[model samples]
Target chain A: MIIVAVLSIIFYLLSLYRGFLIYPGFLLQVAYMLIRGIQLERLPLVGPHDTLFFLSSSLVAFAIPFMFSINDERQFVGSVSVIASVFAIFSLLSRPHNIPLPPVLRTYWFELHVGLSFFSYALFGIAAVLGFLYIRNKDQETEILQYKAVLIGYCMFSLSMIFGGIWAYLAWGTYWLWTPKELWTTILWIFYSLYLHARLRKEWMGMPSVVLGIIGFAVTLFTYLGVSLLMKSSHTF
Target chain B: MLCPAYISVKINMFKKLLAFFFSLRTAIWLLLALLFMLLFGSLIMPARPEFSSLNSMPLFDWLGENKAGITWWLYGSILLLSLLTANTLLCSIESLIRKQQSKKWLLIISPQIIHIGFLFMLLAHLLSSTGSFRGNTVAYEGSALALPNNLAVAIKDITVELSPSGYVSDWAVNIEYLSDGKGIKEDYLKPNSPSFYKGLGIYLKDIRPYPVKTVLLEVSREPGAVWALIGGLLFMLGTVTLMILKIKKESSS
Candidate 1:
């Protein structure tokens, strides 16, 4: 796993100049996840290590589309590669252990819930990068792309929350739990919703909305990692 | 006949209030307020022991019984959400009425659909908060437990599979629904898989196999489950449609 992650990061860095090497890098990450999943006999999304690996893979997956669509491909892809590499490094730092899936996490709904949530996080990650580029370069196109990324991410996150609610209801008989993790999830969702609404106004279009995009991703990361690590909740890994 | 000065002023104030509730700005501000309150509650919940009782019962029941400084954030959030709900309804109504003649029907109607879905979700939570029932019971094999509505559940069997490492590989509980001292239905419950009878659901929370063959089962009745599912579906549908439409429009332009 360490060798695969290091190779993937190297390919991602090489893709900054070559741009085509991203495909191989993304493939390597996916292969690693597939191998882990086959070995574990379940989706490899139970702990921080696997989840971070999944997030890094998703970041590459989402960044692939922009490589062809955007004009500032090098910068955008480079930013994504850097962020994804950091997460990959983080995953490497955390020791991996093979454990059977707990009874509570054996449901298809839970798998879908976790999968979609990480994918949405990846989208938000891309949006934050775009927002940063826009702030640096004052590019109007980057701003527009940021909005589009956020719109898509918001939809996916909403679906993820819905699946989570359904899973919770099935396992615990309540759709929503009053836990710190759940509360932060709602806060993150509403923060993005506020961003969406702020984008509708003319004055908030350029910098304000872009800043929200960046801040929203920070909130997303905190919700995904900080809540589970710092606070006591059912989401503790 | 001319209206009195005070009456005219009062009518103008009422109109201002209506306009405020129907504006997008109000929606944004209310969402921001709710977000802040939720953030505060998230912090306070971990630091305060009083807030731990939040999940012990329905939300309204908790609110009615516990009045403490720690819960002020929740109270404030509920108020903001109520106001936000009103704003959502009025804004959707205003939009539909104003855009009634627009040629882009999907574009015009998509946001309203989302609003309706949000309202339905809020209603689902409200219903569950006020009327939901949750109870936990431990039952051994062949033991019968009584439920609401004169329904009884009999534990028929329990299965626990242990792996080589002595970890629980799989587990399930077989149960029969009895009414009037007769079995009506038989089903099995596993983790994340609950059995539903009428409107009530039975979930196998845990199992103890060695000392005694007993299982911890949780019975709950949520009146809002279906509504929440419907609302979630509609919300997804509207957002997807609106996103597609926007993307197409942007690309074309």
Candidate 2:
């Protein structure tokens, strides 16, 4: 597993010397995984190949954010975000179209549900670093970068949940199921709520907000991905 | 913040009620309740299996069979939802009435947008819970699958292959469907890919070919997608803009 992760990261980074890493590389990873699977003959749930695919795909896309200079990181992340978004559209494209349909991903609610949530997770990732920095360094040098990222993250996380709940409504017919995922998300949302409240109610600012911001984002990651691995939801793992 | 010395029982009752419905106390309680529930799901209990097929009983079904257990879960979640709804609604309303004069447009509008977005989401869930939105998948070359809630999917054709090693090499599917004879269409879906018609979508599940080849698909729909998107975009923009404006002002100063 460690080797696969390393390989995936390497391929993902190498693929970036030019553009478009996950898509073409994804096909190769899939093929390699299938061959490995045949040797194992039967491994359940954690298809190592598919896991590699997902890891590489996510990391490569996430790397774009850090790849840019301070001035250019936003554009770098933005451009890659646009390109990676194409895969989502392509998920709807089944040329001459002979791909077996997988469950857990078939519904519009599920798509938008998972899609918006992941975007929000990515958004949180961007926001989280700033919040972490704010909580760490109390100096003025990091203040501008700190605040900007938190703002972006807060906006994205809120939107993600609202949209995700709406999509859940479409799929599961419930706005909030209080599933482990839902529960943790609400906890995360509440942490943000407290930060907002502290800002207005007590004139709390600076590191306090950033501290909460950092905590909230860690919870947000759990809400999106960690929950699948560590918790349980009606939604697939 | 301060503690009042003493109060009459009646006033205290009112205060507690007010606190329960509007205070952070209620929100925390709701959040805690969900945490316990989630822990139950992950550690002690399991979420009910969503019944997509008749051959197996899902975990949800088994737990729900306890009758009282299902009721507890539902009521617990509702309690949380109600508290959340009240918090968001009242906060927004109070702001609109009390702070409208000094209100920052972004703050005022963003909260309203988010609150109403939550309400709409609740409303859509209400509509769907009653079983209004229903759908199924149909493979191009397979028979119709009878599903619950008066939904069915006809598989048009599902292609499957295995490499010499035996793991599945590829899976492809063509599907068709109709509901109330009005909403009907056909689509081709694959792994990580989905196709939609009449508000319903078909998603590829898994593919296997050994003794015989098979493809699986899951179908779904949601009536509140547009509202969610709208709320999400507005909220994101509002927060980011406000933060940026503050940062810029501070820098210039």
Candidate 3:
């Protein structure tokens, strides 16, 4: 865990320095132009504001898990969670200027449903790594990475469903669409539901649960990005 | 033994096929395939059902016919989901069912609840997509409308506007409600809030005070929606509770 964290930090820092060096041919230069009074809405990949948010977020996400391996840690995980949260907040704010949520969509229900949804996925993103780690190892009795992985993944699954139901009730007058995105999300929730159920029953172990965990995260990624990219969502900005 | 060698060969062949068709590897491939195809669809494919001859195509053309290439896409997606659901259910059925005898029936009941919630969600969305609702603002400080049903809403006044600092400072909506052609209840609504009437719920999504309040009241209704909400909440609570108890027990043991 510590090694992975350290490697991630090194890689993230490298990406940052690379960003600084390659300023002209990319979004940073445009952001620099924006800083000098250009419009923010007209930028491309890796916008200036987005770059900062990713750098800081990746650092926090990379660095926090190291402490868990260092000693019995207290709230280092919680702090990292806060960082992931702030990353989502910045991402929400960093929308392309062409499209923005309507004023009506900016209400408290929107924040609770959509905001919580993003943060939950960010957590699951971290958990996916832990799940993969568990799969690689031959052992499963320990309360190491598998527990943490399943815990966060299941947490995200639960919270997303809750918020989604509420959002659907308010926005479209219904909860589940079984659309590609919704279907994949439900599949993920089911996959993890099986994970938690097996864990509690002490029947499934090692390769099986780990594999499920990893795959659940894969579906989670699709639910997050693949569907949005492929289909026009009912909840589009 | 009688034909021991032949039996062994048959067993080996079955194992190979079983491993091939229904394993974690296939699930991963299925997932990646969904991502790959969806990416392809979004980037290159026409928005929806591109026609060879626009004038020739009928007004209500079949979704599959216009989109010649996407039927397989849709079919393939359903196939993928079926495989995944089968895979997980197969893996976890014994464990899940084994605990049905446990005193904490929550384990058994929770999944059932979640499944019900999922079904309701699917039904609700399908209903919303197919069914239609009409929404138009009744202008003026006091304008009332009589719909086909006895349901009527009188817009006493609506004012919404943002303050100088971009905060919604002055926003208010006054509405008169009626049921069965009789004036019943009236209330003032603001942003971030809503009110309900006879299964017809109205939300003050936003307001812009152009002297008279321009109220954006989002309205939606489906019979027994509250039941779906209740089911969802129960499922979440039950899953969370069951997970915690199981984890604590395992760690303690």
**Highest-scoring model, lDDT:** 1
- Give per-residue CA lDDT, model 3, range B1-253, as digits (tens): 6699999999999888667554555545555565555444444333544522321222123233555464455456545655655554443454366676788676556555554554454444334434425343434566665544588777777766664556565466788887875778997665444566776766665455555555555555555466566656766776566566655655666
- Tens-digit per-residue lDDT, A17-36, candidate 2: 54455445445544544554
Could you say which candidate leads in DockQ? 1
Which has the better TM-score: candidate 2, or candidate 3? 3
Instruction: List A-chain TM-scores for all predictions.
Output: 0.97, 0.55, 0.59
lDDT of 2 at B101: 83
Runs in model 3 lying further than 4 Å from the true structure: A1-111, A135-137, A141-144, A171-205, A225-237, B1-46, B49-140, B165-170, B179-182, B203-219
Write down the C-alpha DockQ for each prediction: 0.82, 0.15, 0.15
Best by TM-score: 1
| TM-score of decoy 3 | 0.59
**Per-structure clash totals for the candidates:** 0, 28, 5
Q: Point out where model 2 deviates above 4 Å.
A: A1-148, A158-186, A203-211, A217-237, B1-74, B102-104, B126-142, B145-154, B160-172, B176-204, B209-213, B217-253
lDDT-wise, the better of 1 and 3 is: 1
* Whole-structure CA lDDT of model 2: 0.51
| lDDT of residue A231 for candidate 3 | 57
Worst 10 contiguous positions by lDDT, candidate 2 chain B: B50-59
Cα lDDT of model 1 by residue, B1-253, tens digit: 5669989999999999998998888988999889989999998899978777777578889888876577899889889999999998888888899999999999999988888888899999899889888888889999999998899999999999888888887898899999999999999998888999999999887888888888888888888898898998889889889999987887676
